[model samples]
Target: MSVEEEDCPPLLETCAGERGNEDDDSDGWDEMEVSGEQTTCLFCPLQFHTIAVALDHCRSDHNFDLLSLKAKYDMDCYSYIKMINYIRLQKPHPKILTESSVALWEDDVYLKPGDMETWLMYDFDDLGSAPSTPHYAIDGKAPISNLSFSDLQRQIQELTIQLKHKDMLLENCHKDMEHMRKVTKTIVDSGDSLNKKIPNNVISSGCDSSDYFNSYSHFGIHHDMLNDAVRTEGYRDAIYKNIKMFAGKIVLDVGCGTGILSMFSARAGAEKVIGVDQSEVLYKAMDIIRENNLQDKIHLIKGQLERVNLPEDKVDIIISEWMGYFLLFEGMLDSVIHARDTFLKPDGLILPNRCNISIVGVDDIDRYNKVVNFWDDVYGFSMKCMKSEVLREAFVEIVPPEKVITNSVILTEIDIRTCDVNACIFSSTFTLSAHKDGMLTAIAGYFDTFFDLETEVRFSTGPHATRTHWQQTLFYLPDTIVVKKGDRLEGTVSCTRLTKNVRGLSVTITIGKNKYHYSLD
Candidate 1:
């Protein structure tokens, strides 16, 4: 028969042949077209026995009545059928389809037989064919049966919710970035901020005489004075003998400000000498090296000791002048620890092998009384009107150290020769109490070094001491108080290792010999 013949048999009959004849007798007895089955499709001229076939023909041939076709025939047909079959199959045993029943077959679209291999390789789902087994539920419920259109809808809804959440997170991140930018700009604009570059002249001038006398007088002689002292016969003989201990060995001078110690190492006949520092003082040292024609023996690196890139276990000796004012004020000893761990050989020596810091009670009663009386006069005023004025004048005055009560504690004893600079963390606890009624002046502190077995260095409280410009700095307290004899004060000192040479130390002080106490934090 021709493809367009109206007398063509049904698809089942054409495919199954004679075995499909069982249902033929029910609709037989006439060769004429049934009048009620002559529905015409509006999209095309095709006529059919059912609206479904007519609609399908119209869509395929003329692209017509799309809304009607979708409404009637495209309502997740496979999903619905699979759901029905899933329900029936749950009963178990030889499955059979009744005349009035329906069946659904839903399976993982990607894991079906033909697509399984492809899914394994690419992790992608194939949408080319209907599934043969049920994998999801129909309606909005769990699969007592199998796959359903409602489940697909739910998946789509969940994906939409996730996308919305991601968008909200992105918006918040943008707001944070804007806030950070504003804060950074404000910090940059602040004129006195330390992050801003310091003037070269200011850094080069070293510490002034006032700073020296106010803070460092008790500690030790300056570097220049020490150099002069070393030039004398007695000092020279002692220093020479010390240098002879490390002769013809590799040596490192850390925080080598002017490369003086490195030069000493070179003069001592060390096979090689390397000096490192962050200050521009290396330039002056370079000139000195050339002038003395010692350039061939020494090498200098311009950087922080912690960041100096050198091979591990490469040096025979590690030397440094890292002590800060108040012994632990700037926490530069942390850097010395790093150099010791990374560059020194296991058995190498450290110059000034150890340092001892001690605390003692002293008398300075007159100085403490003056500062307390001054603050009392100011507090007597109506603070509401003079708050700003009081604040502006607070830092201008200086008080004597002895008036302030002190219960000192030893922070730590460092053996540079054996201490692992990388792992050391310094911490301590202290309590300060007034022994007598007085005005607080300043805290007197100092450090002593054991350079080797017999030779030693000490900074003492005296005049005409050799002074290198790096005098100790005073951490002036914000306010001074008056205390009578036998008042007790107590607090703790906390220190954290920050970097190679830097440490952060914080002291908390509580006042009053009895129940009265205040904290700095």
Candidate 2:
């Protein structure tokens, strides 16, 4: 440990004190009062007369040695203060501290002093004053140690109150966790013998927004979309057919995955095209734009629409292929809406300005048996217990037109040019009359986009239309319901955005007295 210390100098005083004089107060130790003041044990509720005795109790009772921890982490004065405060306020188990690779107190919130004020004690300072310890020296004296006793006491009181508010927030978060756990367990029954363990990431709170954006960084997702003729041609024709509107106009493409739409606009004689994305895919997109010789006409920016700047003051048109499965699954429309509100001119056109989400009943027993019943006998192992979880998530697949048993009903239509973010979460009731007598095993959803220009270019992902990358989203029922030729199924379908993961959707379909819930994540 002594050799390691010589190899690496300790962090300087400015580590936390850089904030202001408030941090300097951490070092104003009044040894006379500090040595006699009563303190609590770090890992337990026991009290000691002095910080030295309290540390000794921690080493013996909890196997937590402060000196050894300092040596292992190469901690400096600020780290020591942070560690003392963390253990006092968070009450974390000693094992968790031992597993850390670094001090793990780099977060400024941990620098705030807690009630213990353990840094004021001599035993804590002894570690910093040791000859073998590395510390920033100024004429053989540390600047913080010269602070007056009163300044330290006042600073501690202010810092302690600040930490109390943080503690309250943490308590509320714990309550929210408990509530979500109960709600999730109720949504999916816990008695399934095949599935007993529920990992923390399965909970919505465990999801990070970065994980959602990082998914688009991969090549396969782009490859699938680029290879889909129906999807690519829809955007291509929308720009080419409305050449009069796109010619000599500035266009902004939000959530531009591979800069395809930007290049399309450039090909349509746009004066300039700006494509913005917040994923690693933008690096490759830069190379793609240069390779196509469209670099002079297109500029690719890497950031969210709300934060990034566009070269033009206001664009004359905005082109984006932001549709997801079931029309609004990934919530990419929110980004497009933000771009519209921030960068587009008052009369700017949004390519594919209109979109329609429709629902149609499907009579595909083969798919139902393959997805759900296949679990009943997986190599003769009776895995029917896994069916409950399988039924909770919607599937994106193609259902043949012949299998559709009812006429399509338009659930909702979104005008991208005028819609806000809240419009994405919507509910609509529909009554689908069966055109032929058949067993309705699932409800399939598809969307159609309209350019609404002079040519009015439009494309559909419905079962009767040409297939696209977003084939169709299917929600299979637990049991097939029999229907006559003229029978109508009355129900309400609602799409809601999940609180924790904004990109994820929670869908509920109610048919008469039965309600089915599913997640699109």
Candidate 3:
């Protein structure tokens, strides 16, 4: 054993007196001397018979300062030479030093159980005495000592797990946003396509005024039936001609208003003719079928095309006069598509295969004066209370010629026979440019349809077209602005179809040399 190891008490020797004297006879020490050592340690003190026994006791119990002991002994006294050197530099004895010296030598001290226990009870006052030192700073700069490499590895693993979870959450959020965007786009497009400005008074089966059509003949006959004498002769002649050509073929009559078209098909020698309509209009059609005594040849069913119960690929011909005020007013063409898909064979024919909208400009001087006077009253006051109400009323009255722009300029004509309603996305945009400058008056718009075999319905710039309960819709410019003949009126009208029945349409107009614009919802 080295001189240093011999001088410092071994850990086992310090606690030996606490145990009963099992080696009392082996050691030469008397009972009084052992008791004195026990009093110093406040426990049992160790006994030694030889140098080897003392060295073994120090190694086993004290974790002795081996490098210091080795310097006094031979260099080869400790088998682990590097371990001894490491302990000499890193582990320092706190008992031999003052409190101030111990604090200054903190970096050289090893963490011991006694030191840890003392730290648990250490007060803030003791910590403040060691200024310029971090309270939690551990002794030594070695990673193994300061950070505990195993604990650090476990923390890294936990962070990786948390990161993976966050990435999955982010991916899910992205998918949800994409789905919401698609749904919103669908709704907006549908709103655009089915919007129309048909007059509230026009009696149509699907419109709000459908109930009025029942008693409408008291005021005026249905527009399609107005030319009854001509329609009857034409129907009879067409039926005779078609029946001879298509003997034993099945036929369908869409919007079979009074079943007149179905009757014509039955008379045309069709093997089967089915008439479908949503309104009690089918009842009227039944009456016509009975009056013509063709009930056995025709079958009448009541349902909308969207939910119509019909067998697929069964009919050879589809016939109907489903046109509304401006070609799409009541969204009747949708029903026609449904009928075509459900009943018609691949080679089936559609009556009135193509319909084109024709528009013309007409002068309405009275409407201009009304709109100007109304705006004047509004501007004269500061309230601005009735702007929306005024705008609504103004759009309904006074069909001015300037509002009429030809489809040739703005729209592509619809071919009902070849058009696939499912695959199609419809958009209608209008750019209104001023043709001539005058006191801005009312704007008017109208339409005409061209059917097969030179048959036509001309809703013209005449008294009857304008006088009917379903008059052309109109919009009056806000206030009269003095405009030059060449001044441009720039605006756009846009429409997107959501479904067969629902559509969205908006018109934006700019009038003036400098182009003042306004939008109507």
Candidate 4:
């Protein structure tokens, strides 16, 4: 049977529960002048008298249901604009539209129109679950008084969404304050007991780890991590490339910021994936999961791994991006270890099961002068006293591989699946032989992670590899030492968690007769 006008109904009727006032149809519905234009099919070049006819042709002929696609992705007005522009520019096949990820239309460049799209003006609010301003209103061209009845409703809905977002932020702030108070009270109450447990040589001087978890409540830090391609892609490949390991497995993500890894696991055919986080960002992660339509396979809990109870008893795999500067400065591995012991099954595996921290001597006089000597004479005044404090802080920066003067030595190799929490705090002896005759002014540390899958997935945050957010942790010596080629510098490096802030590290380097102490906080 050939499709006709009566067979294909108006576009507004297809939008379930999103129609506006019925009386508006009689109140100058033709004011927009939508008639008399030939609308093109979204997937084909066929022309129709109206948009409803074109959309109906797309559904009947191409089997592309726009309403279902919009509902599935929960695209906002901007997204719809981008999608329309994308189709006009790309002219992708209907199969591509059905199988492609929503991220295909996420580029901001697609927000601009390739041509005038009058069809996008119809049933805008029905395209998204959330209330959002139309893209034109964002440009300040559309005002409330001049807006159509639907646009006016969208404007009010946008304000309601903004109010809800603000209220959520205020509630998160209150929760953060209460959490800080409880942490401070616990630290003060346990001061005497904690001091007795810490070593006598360990010194604590730096900001306390009181706001460690709360610091992730903002979007900037998560943005930095997500933008690091090496860091983000490494996790994605580790989970996606090894589909056999993740298929039908129940996975646990510790410190699952933004729930990216959990979503990856869910997409990799995992039966279930749970993400546990202590920061308020977990709320945002929950919304992101919903937006991506992965809320069914992935679940999130906003609490510490040790305190929270999982919906499932045992998980087949535990994955976490818990590494910090020099591999363990943030003390997140302790939580991962707790999750492993409490929740992981007997045969469960950890993503990036192996991590190796390496150190190399560098002869970067320019960096040494800028970081250390700059304080000696600040604006023609003697400010050398500040150099002591400066030298005690380990700097996170990128050291050119050409500046390296000695061979790299492995400081520690951590097997997350078997290593205990105490493994992170230990003394290791290493010998670095000078590869060239140059001054040794500082020691730089970097780490590499390995997934140990069928095809091992690994990335290095070393000077030679592409830079990650971790970069390299550099510890400057109090004074420089010159040596010839093949000269060996044997030293003992010890890491101890600070008494005041257990999440921070106090590293001590002891050479023959000299010693240097630095803090990684």
Best by TM-score: 2
lDDT (Cα, tens digit) per residue for candidate 1, span 269-316: 888887776665566666777788777777776656655565334898
Q: Give the range where candidate 3 is weakest over 10 consecutive residues by summed lDDT.
A: 34-43
Candidate 2, 1-521: lDDT as tens digits: 33543553233222232323533554322221212235667778787655556667888999888888988978776777767765554455686577543343434456654554434433344563434322222122233453344655666677779888899989977887887799687757757735755321111223223776799999999999999998898789888887888889998888888999999899999998888888778878887987999888888877667765567789999888889999999858988888888888999898879999999999988889999899988887999889989998899999999999998999889999888776555667889999999999999999998989888788999999988989999999887899999999998887756544667777778898787888898
Better of 1 and 2 by lDDT: 2
Worst 10 residues of 1 by lDDT: 115-124
Best by lDDT: 4
TM-score, per-candidate, Cα-based: 0.44, 0.61, 0.46, 0.60
Clash counts for all predictions? 35, 0, 23, 0
lDDT of 4 by residue, 1-521 (tens): 22542463354233222334645543322222222346668877778665556667888999887777887788777887877876665555675566543324545657643445445654566433364333333222333233455754554566677788789989977887787799677877886875645322112222222488889998999999999999999999988888888999999989898999999999999998888888878878877988999878888877667776688999999999999999989858889889889999999998879999999999999989999999888899989999999999999999998998999899889999998766655667789999899999999999999989897899999988998999999999999999899999988787656544668877888776787888887
**Clashing residue pairs for model 4:** none
lDDT against the true structure, each candidate: 0.46, 0.76, 0.45, 0.77
Candidate 4 segments whose C-alpha is farther than 4 A from its true place: 1-210
Query: Which wins on lDDT, candidate 3 or candidate 4?
Result: 4
Error of 4 at 422 (Å): 0.3
Error of 4 at 369 (Å): 0.6
